[model samples]
Target: MNIQNVTVIGAGSMGHQIAMLSALAGFDTNIHDVNEEVLKQARHKLNKIMDKWVGKDKISMEERDRAFEKLYFTTDLEEAARHADLVIEAVIEKLDVKQDVFEKLDKAAPDHAGLATNSSTIVSSLIADVTSRPDKVCNMHFFFPPLVMDCVEVVKGEHTSEETARLAMDVCKRMNRTAVLLQKEISGFIANRILFAIQKEAMALYEDGYADFKDIDKITRKALSHPIGPFELMDLSGIDVGYYVMLQQYAETGDPKDKPSKTLVDKVEAGELGKKTGKGFYDYHSRI
Candidate 1:
C-alpha cells in the first residue's frame, strides 16, 4: 500500500508509543487527542523516553532528532486523519466510542486509506459496519508498551478483505513489528485468552484460601519461570482495564463466569487503578 502518513488516535500509553514507533520507522506520524493536556503530556513523555534511549546508546541522537521531526501532535481529529494513509485508532476500549471514531474516520480519511484498531479484544467487525469502508477495517492489536513489544496481532474480521489484512501486516512490518495473523475474529484474541484463563485460575486459588496472592505470584515466577506474576502483571496492566475487558466479555457472552473477580472490582472501586494511579493489587506509592 506504500503507506506514508500514519495517524494514531488517542495520546494515551499505547497511542503515543505507536506514533513514536511509526515515526522511528520513517513514516510521518500524527497523534491526535481530544484533550490538549493529554497531547502535552504525551509529547513530554515521548521526548523523555527518546532521550533515555539515546543515553543508553540504543538510538543515536541524530536518529532521535529525526524521529521527533517526523512526529506531530494535535487536538484536531479530522486534521490528523485527513491525509493519513493509515489510521490506527487507540482510543478507550468502549464499543460506542470506537464506533463513533471509525464512522468519522471513514468520512475524514481518504478512500484508499486503511483503518485499524489497537483494541485488545473488540473485533473490527463489531465496529466496521458503522463505516462505509468495512473492507478496509481490521484489528492491529499491539501489546502493552508498544515500544518494547515486538508482536502485533493482525486480525481479519468477517467483512475485512484479504488485501486489507495483507496491507495491515505490511504496515506492521514497516513499524518493525512482527505481525501475527489471525484468520478469524475471536474475543481476547490468542495471548490474552490464555493469560485470562491463567489469571482466573490464580484468582480462584487465592479466593479459595489455598494460597496468598504474593505466594501465588512467587510460585508462578519460580516454577513457571515467568518474568512477572499474574497479580503483578494485572497491577502493571491496570486492574480497571482488566475489569472493563471482563465486563465487555461477559456482556458479549451473557455468562456470569466471564465477569471480573471481586478482588478486581473492589480494587477499581477503591480508585486503585494500578501503576498509573500508584496502587492496584500492590502499592506503588511507597516505591515510586
Candidate 2:
C-alpha cells in the first residue's frame, strides 16, 4: 500500500508532533483542530523545533524547507479527511469525542482512507467499534516527542484487517521508525502496561511510607537502571494527566490494582499538576 496523504485530527501535542514527523518524512500532511489559536501555536512550535534541528545538522536545510512545504493545517475536518489516504485521530481521551470524529470520518473520508488513533490507554478493540468500517481502524500509538521518538505501536483490534495492520507498519517504517505489531488487542498495549505496573507499585510503596518519594526515585534509577524514577517521570508527564489516566483505566476495568494511587489523586486534586503546573511530587517553581 503506497500511502501518501495523511490527515491528523486534533492539534494537541501528539497531533502536532505527528504532523511534524509526517512532513519530515515527506508526506502530504494536514492537521485539523477546532481552535485556530492552537493550530497556529502548533505550526509555530514545529517550525522552531525544525529550525533547531537544521542548525544542529540533524536535517538538511533543503529537507527542512521541504518539510514546511509539505504541511497543511486547517480547521476543516472534512476538507482534511477528503484528500487523505490515512486519517489519524489524536483528540481528547473521551469515548464520545472519539466516536464523534469517527462518525464524521466515516462520511467525509475517501473509501480507501484508513483510520488510526494515537490513544495511549483506550484499547483499539473498543474504539474500532466506533466505525462501520472497523476493518479500517487500528492503533498507531506514537510516543512523546514523535519527531525524535522512532518507535510506534501498530496495534490490531478485533475487526482490524491484516492489510490495515500492514499499511500502518509500512507507514511507520517509511517514516524511519520501528513498529512493534501487537498481534492482538490488549489494554494499555505493551509499554504503558509494563511501565505503569511498576509505577503504580512504586506509588503504593511511597504512599504507605515504605520510602520517601525522592528516595524511591533514586533507588529505582540506581538499582533498576531506569533513566528516571516513577514520580519524577510523572512530574515530567504531568501529575493530573497521570492520575486521570490511571483512574480512567480503573473505571474501565474496575481493577483496584490499576486504580489511581491515592497519593497521586490527592496531589492532582490539590492542583499540584506536576511540571506543567510548577509543583507536583517535586517543586518546579524555583530551582530545577
Candidate 3:
C-alpha cells in the first residue's frame, strides 16, 4: 500500500491540486498533460498556493521546498506512469477518453501499481471494462478543491479487489483525504447524487416561477448554512460541466428530473461559462 511515486495523468485544476498534495505528503509526484501550457499553469497555480501556505505559517520553508522538489513535471504519459506506484487519471469526464487512457495504463503501469479514476460521474465499471486489469482499477473521486476537501469517494467496481481498494484507501490517507469506500458504483457516486437531487428541486422551484436565482442562493446560504448555493456551485464548477453531468445522469437513470435547466444550456451556449470564463450565474471577468 506504500507508494513513493504517484502519477497524475492530467494537469487541470484537480490534477494540479493532487500533484501538490501528493508531493506535500512525501510522495514523488509526477504530473503529465498533452499540452505544455497546462503543465506550466499547473506549476504556477501550485506555487501560488504554497506561497500562501508559507505566508499563513501553515507550512515551513523546508516543507515547501521539499514539495516543489519532489514534484516532477512531464508531457510524456507513458514515461510518467512507467515507474509510478499509482496512477490517477483526472482527464476530461468522457467515458471513451477515460477508457482509452486506462487501456494504455494497463500496459504502462507497473504490475503491482494501482490505477484510479478521478471521474466525477462516469461509472467505474465502464472504465474498468476497457482496462485489461480491472481488478487493479477503482474510483478515487476527490472533490473540486482536493487540497482543502477531505472526502475522497473510493468507489469499488464489481470486479475490483479488496486489496486494490485497501491500497487506494491508504493512498488517500497519505494525501490527508478522508477515504470512504462505497460497496458499489452508483451514478454520480455519493456526494454528487445528493447534490444533484437538491439541484433538481431548486431548478424546479426556479423554473416553476416560485423563486429567482439570487433569492434561492440567499435562502440556501442563510438557512442551509451552505457557503454557496447549487447554482453558484455550478457556476464555479463551470455551467457546461454541470450541464453535461446532468445530461449524463438523465441518460443513465432515465429520469426527466435529472435533466438540467434551460438557463444552464443558454449560458453555456453564450460562452458565459462560470469562474473559468469569469462569468456564468455571475460575472467575474471584469474584476469588479
Best by TM-score: 1
Cα lDDT over the full model 2: 0.86
Which residue pairs come into collision in candidate 2? Answer: none
* TM-score of every candidate: 0.98, 0.94, 0.96
- Tell me the lDDT of model 2 at 6: 92
**Cα error of candidate 1 at position 208, Å:** 1.9
Which tens-of-lDDT digit does each residue in 21-130 have in candidate 1? 99999999999999999999999999999999999999999999999999999988889999999999999888889999999999999999999999999989999999
Instruction: Report how far off residue 124 is in candidate 3 (Å).
Output: 1.1
Candidate 3, TM-score vs. the true structure?
Answer: 0.96
Off by over 4 Å in 3: 286-288
Off by over 4 Å in 1: none
Q: Which portions of model 2 show Cα errors greater than 4 Å?
A: none
Across 1-288, the per-residue lDDT of candidate 3 in tens digits comes to: 668999999999789998888998899888999999999999899889999999999999899999999999999988899898989999987677888999988888888888899988987888787767889889999998898888999999898999999988998888888999999878899899888878878877888999997799989999999999988888777787788887777778897767777887788789998888888877786766
In the range 139-241, model 2's lDDT, one tens digit per residue, is 9999876887889998987799999999999888888889999998877889988988888889878888999999999999999999899889898867766
